[model samples]
Target: MSRSCSFSLCAHDWSAYQLAEQLGRGVAELWPSADRGRYAVLNRLAELGYVATRQELTGKRARTIYSITPAGREALAAWLGTPPRPPSVEFEGMVRVLLADQGSLDDLRATLQQTRESALANRDMFARYAAYISATGGTFPERRHLFALANTFMIGHYDHILPWTEWAEQQIADWPDTVTPASTNEAQVRDMLAPGREVWEHDHPDGA
Candidate 1:
């Protein structure tokens, strides 16, 4: 997904300070190449007429609050309307796991552990957002509905990854010293390993 979409969503219901903090945690660290800084991203959004800045004078000093403009919403909608590009994540941890056949089991464990740790961290992050939404009694029903969906996706993602990583760690820990390939695709190999779990493994006469 484009950075613009994430930024637009952040401004949808949050103040500038909140957005900056979230951007720092989510985008700045996740995609540092695309990000300059929190203020720079906000300013770019303003320059493009996709975000509006309002000056608010607090008791101490002035602050800037940003909101996504009509154009911004339209842009975001257009992005959502089209099919997204293929996933091209740059996570080196996964890259190591992909080429694990060339490396030692210890290296595989270390790389998968990194991914597992990352998944747990992200799980905690979204759990806080989920708690916030819950505490508010589902405030902003429409927007919060989508935010809740995103939170659910992230939570589910990590939930799956956590167990998968654990399973992978165990499998690697007990990997055969002279194992050879039985299948090419992971799903096929998984089915070869799993006795009767997946329905897709069945040859249905009705093709149902």
Candidate 2:
């Protein structure tokens, strides 16, 4: 995905620089490599039939914002209904977890401390964005909705990670002597059969 395309996808307006800034912010938040993040956005836009380019508007070099065609809006609506694919997690604490044997308890603690700080900072930023959305009425109507959704997602994300981090810290302090793998056979079996059950048994029992 090109940066241009990705920027266009999320933006209601088509300012290239603004798109670039948003791309940078997304890269930081999502932790993808710069090239990959830009390309992903471009690819998605292409798939949706939206072109990203700069053109002269009113004799000024301005981003020629392409309006979403009816088909494009329909595609976006369909895409929105599906859960976003999980971004690759590049969290530093996970690396520390893998190399915990190489480091002392203090090192682990520090790593976790830094991770928590980063999470809190991110939470604050999202909160601020949500506030901005509430304050500004003239920005994209859809953007206000997207901001709310992003805030909700961020809250859930923090809620999930904060607890896990706390649990991990406690576990490290207590220092388990043995690790046991839980049984996942039943869950795995259910997961494997879940699609067929939903599709064949529920949605199309008579083979439509």
Candidate 3:
């Protein structure tokens, strides 16, 4: 599961639509999938008793608004007191590594090359964002933090992935001509039971 932080404001003082937009932009600048991701965070907050929704009358249509409860504020304060864990990242290259033997060595090499290119592209994008932040006079603390975090994440990814991709490619290039499949054993077990007791045994009949 992914960890996220949620903050709620007073519904009476704020519009849900506007709040959604602000949060969407704030999260998008820092993370991927802004709207969906922020909504997910809000929804989780609601479940945690941090936010409650109410219907508001507006001319022709009713609008939904969200408010933060006292409990929510306390929860947020407590969360702030704790150190935040870095977000989790998933890489498809790991799956390729696990199934490396299923494909040709040349194909593996191509995949590794593509992975390297993608990582480099990401690094460049983060660098550009960092430069943009610096050029803008660094006026917005939030934006500065967002860009810095993004830059850090991208650099860390490149540092780890570049070496890993190179190693994977080299391994493929030097792979043996033939790979022998390891032997698999299947056995059946019979349980002994006392006169009045029943014995239990669990096994895959097909030995999958």
Candidate 4:
């Protein structure tokens, strides 16, 4: 909830259903049961006086709408002022590739293919989302700048994944089997490692 406020103030008025849908797409997909989980969280926030809830009629049905309290805004402001931890990478595809020698090469190839497909799908979805936000300014026109920056990063991530998986798949194509070190392409490995080595050596002049 605090993180949502950091992105947009209008998020203060979202219903739990809306929060679940928006968070599932724009942020991390809620696990287990998003709707139930968000409803429970919203109730807790209300109990803590961080959010206030009111019943509003939508046609024939009445839904509970939550709005952040002054306390919520203060909490969100404090969260934004704090420095965030470093980004973490948790790519299952990369993990499989790293340990591929201990498993079947076919499994690695399938993982790469699945990764590429997932990236493609994400790219297409985000492309449409960007277009929507660009054309319509989305729900929060005031925060379009933040959304633009985030969408750009997501697009770049998918762009990198697509080509990288393609390159990895090509490398796997030439391998005879998984385990043999003799099947490794030493020159290709060195070429791939060159940029990192150069940067590390440049930073540590004494080779420390």
Candidate 5:
């Protein structure tokens, strides 16, 4: 399977490379160059009759195309019904912030700037994706509603990132250094806790 399989999908036929691209670009990180594991899973699915594979020649090369069987759809539906684990973040910039005392304030500021820039770029990317889907009607027009929901979640994630980085930057600007003893901003802390506190108070009024 190659990454450049085809831009078009014939029914539900998908190459292993295509699946890797979808997973990586959408939500997960899958390296196409080291795709032995992905191919193994696909092969296993074929063995279980969840997916069927066919060889098709594209020019001088033959590619393996896979289509989900009824069993595969059933498996997918069942998986979807299960509760997913909470989202986990693997951001190097956040790690740097967590260890900011080990580094200079300059380093922390730079990391914050980089994080904000990345969030901005991701926001633009999602905007373009939404616009493209709106204009060209998307690759799967039948699944437009699902796509919109996914896009909203992705956009919301970046939206949260941008504001958080901005807020962190503002806080850092008032700090003399990463290690120096600084007084806490009580107002800021209270503001940050307001929403949760309000919810808690509403749930348990008058300490009841």
Candidate 6:
């Protein structure tokens, strides 16, 4: 089947109205990162032939329900063949590190300490989520197979980052106060960056 749109958010064997509510709920949870205008986007998909719309009456009101066409499903399958983009992170902590030289070493150290705390707290939250997953393996009972992969990756991501942030904070602590606009020399720059390697080694002894 040929599709005019690249793909639609419609699910197999589901109507547009059914999908709209579910997708809206999902996007609400994703909030800032995910687009919130799902109804308009789904209408666009319908217009593009990636989705077919059907009207159904509920009480006195009519609802538009969307479902994937054969062409739409084919397009989605083709999309699966395309390579994904590289992961992008919007980390403020990294921004601080990039500009760490501007402020006093103490200030930068404090920033890194905050980053470490944030990462640790997030890691703890991930741990709690992990336990919840283990405890209730059948809650909601939808898409567990796919959600498992997502949750596992998220937990591991936080797990690795916590230690890494701990290392970064340690490095900032060991950083010299003299390097705070005291001199313009290669040795001072090296002093600020190089000594951190040992701290990193200490944090990541296995060295991956």
Q: What are the per-residue Cα lDDT tens digits for candidate 2 across 1-208?
A: 3433433554465554455566555335644555355534643665657554445565655545443445566666676689977767777787886677676677777777777777777777767766777888424566567557766887677667776677667655644321221132446447646867887777777867
TM-score of each: 0.65, 0.58, 0.53, 0.85, 0.77, 0.57
Candidate number of the best lDDT: 4
- Candidate 4 per-residue C-alpha lDDT over 75-137 given as tens digits, one digit per residue, 9 for 90 to 100: 777877899857666577788888888888899899999999988988887888899988999
In model 4, residue pairs whose N, Cα or C atoms come closer than 3 Å (at least 3 residues apart or on different chains), thus clashing, are none
lDDT of 1: 0.67
Give stretches of model 3 more than 4 Å off.
1-41, 47-49, 52-70, 80-89, 137-150, 176-208
lDDT of 6 by residue, 148-204 (tens): 675677667667777776776654454466354435455745776776888898999
Clashes (backbone N, CA, C under 3 Å), per candidate, total 0, 7, 0, 0, 0, 4
lDDT of 4 at 7: 35
Best by TM-score: 4
lDDT of 1 by residue, 74-116 (tens): 7777877899767555677777877778877677888888899
- The positional error of residue 109 in candidate 2, measured at the CA in angstroms, is 1.3
Candidate-wise lDDT, in order? 0.67, 0.59, 0.59, 0.74, 0.71, 0.59
Per-residue CA lDDT of candidate 3, range 1-208, in tens?
Answer: 0122343263233465666655543344345544455455667767879777788989988986777778877776787799886885556766775576687666667778999998777767657666767888343445567547756766786777888788656544545421422212111111112212332123434444
| lDDT minimum window of 10 residues, candidate 4 | 29-38
Question: RMSDs, each prediction?
Answer: 5.4, 9.0, 13.4, 3.1, 4.9, 7.1
Please write out the lDDT profile of model 5 over residues 58-104, one tens digit for every residue. Answer: 89999998887777766766766899757667677889988998989
Model 3 TM-score relative to the real fold: 0.53
Model 4 spans > 4 angstroms off: 5-12, 29-37, 182-184
Poorest stretch of ten by lDDT in candidate 6 = 1-10
Ranking by TM-score: 4, 5, 1, 2, 6, 3
